[model samples]
Target: MTAADFAGTKTALALASSDVTMREAFVETVTAAMDTDPRIAVVTADISAGNFAEARSRHPERVVNVGIREQAMIGVAGGMALTGLRPVAHSYAPFLIERPFEQIKLDLGHQDVGAVLVSIGASYDDPVWGRTHQAPGDVALIDTLPGWTIHVPGHQDEVRALLSTALAGDDRVYLRLSTRRNSRAHSVEGFTAVRTGSKGVVVAVGPMLDSVLAATSTVDVTVLYAATVRPFDHAGLRAAVGSNANVVLVEPYLRGTSAHKVATALADVPHRLLALGVGREEEVRAYGTAEQHDVVHGLDTAGLHHSITHFLG
Candidate 1:
């Protein structure tokens, strides 16, 4: 599928190797959750209707559309949460997190209330939209707010697992969906070891796993896959470390968002670190396909391999 396919309307399942888009899994999970529990609700900020037609038709009362008002969308979800209802709010990452940051901070964070803040277009999911739509700082912003569980699901099945877990809880949670997806589904919680090697370890967050594996195909390094990274699986990370103790964090979001956690996780052990992700030094004003952005940012497999080689060597 092309970048346009992901940016366009969400439709029937288009499975590649038995894997689906994270958004599809989200709609299915939320729809099913709402079916079993009346307290659950979904709020969208003027997104496409094709993706959520089933939920809108089946439970019009529970599914809300606040129009272009991204901030108001969060406020509405916050209000709903205060009144004994579980609200799940969504939009493109920028509209969801950047535009409505205040509402998320005050309306929900301050009130000590919780809602499931799901967003698509992670980082440069739709690179053609340019910086106005790109959001590499979404997770970083959420990091500032305490007590928020962040789930960066790599596959649709993982999206289902994480979304279901988020809805089942009352704590504030942010589920980040993206055009980038992993071919494999990791249903297990926490961090799962994808490969083991004697020369240090690499941590791949969400959709970065597939590229990471391809990048490190010839390298001797253990790879740890994280579907849910908020709580940062310290134990699994510690366990994944090998004799080299050199670490590389391959996150799909901002570079070094988890650098602190990684450093702290292996503080006792001597380790060198290289954090990789979208750069924040300047705006990538250019617009094209997601691959174009990845190429520019050195996120493609070749680039990843180069970075890993330099870091490990």
Candidate 2:
């Protein structure tokens, strides 16, 4: 347990109660940074009060509320960033990325302006909000850009780590912070192997960590929680799975984004291969909520367990 290369000011963050949220952890970190650096700004695409109450209370003026217009809010945040202000643009995942694809890609990413994009209640909590709101393909779509750094906190701790790193770095970062209770992970300070085994490698992204652990234990396999997706932990995974003939990737994103990318990376390599992800081709219609969909799509406990077991055996 050596010190992280850059843990920010909250080294004691992991020592907290169980009710913490990655969204909260991330906000707290940003709030702290803002306390020191007046140039740090927080922007909201209409839902600032609900998603970032803590942040707004502290920096009321810093929170540039645009009242539901996500695209315009992002443009403002980008403008702020280019003007030497570190801005965090907060909004719902679906609207933030999908609704403003052109703005984010062109105005923010292509401009090379670094703004931290935080999407709250990210993947599947809105069972009642229906498909349009429940699952946002933010991580999958944004990560496609060349330099965007993607962060999906499995738990509060990992959220803190990634947020801390993103705050200190100059790269554009997108975090899909889950708004669901069950979607929280315990948090690992740095992106390190949660566990490793010899049979094969299981790379779990986001809150699918439990499924990964279950599959590995059931099959006596090795697994890695890729807390960060953009960079893809290429070196760490390669070292861990070095000469193995089997590797599996599990993610909450649509198949095209997460697992598929991993499978393609190892496409030419020698190994048994499998990728488990939500199918993007299907029209999203709020079948039941993200959790229910995970179960249906086999991203949940039963599904992940099944996918890993069948793949390994």
Q: Which candidate has the highest TM-score of all?
A: 1
Give model 1's TM-score versus the native structure.
0.92
lDDT of each: 0.87, 0.73
Query: Where does model 1 exceed 4 Å of error?
Result: 1-19
Instruction: Provide the lowest-lDDT 10-residue window in model 2.
Output: 181-190
Q: Model 2 — TM-score against the truth?
A: 0.86
List TM-scores for all candidates, in order.
Answer: 0.92, 0.86
Could you give candidate 1's per-residue lDDT for residues 115-216 as a string of tens digits? 999999999988777787889999999999899999998888888878888899899999999878887787548889899888878999999999999999
User: How well does model 1 score by local distance difference test?
Assistant: 0.87
Worst 10 residues of 1 by lDDT: 9-18
lDDT of 2 by residue, 1-313 (tens): 3357346324445345356766677777787888777878888766655656766788787877888788898899889888888888877788778888889998888888898888876666666776667554677678667788787777776777778777776779888787443344554432467776777888777777866786567576677777777777666666767788687877777664665555556666776768777766666565565667777667777777877778777
* Every model: Cα RMSD to truth: 5.9, 5.1
Please report the candidate that would top lDDT against the real structure. 1
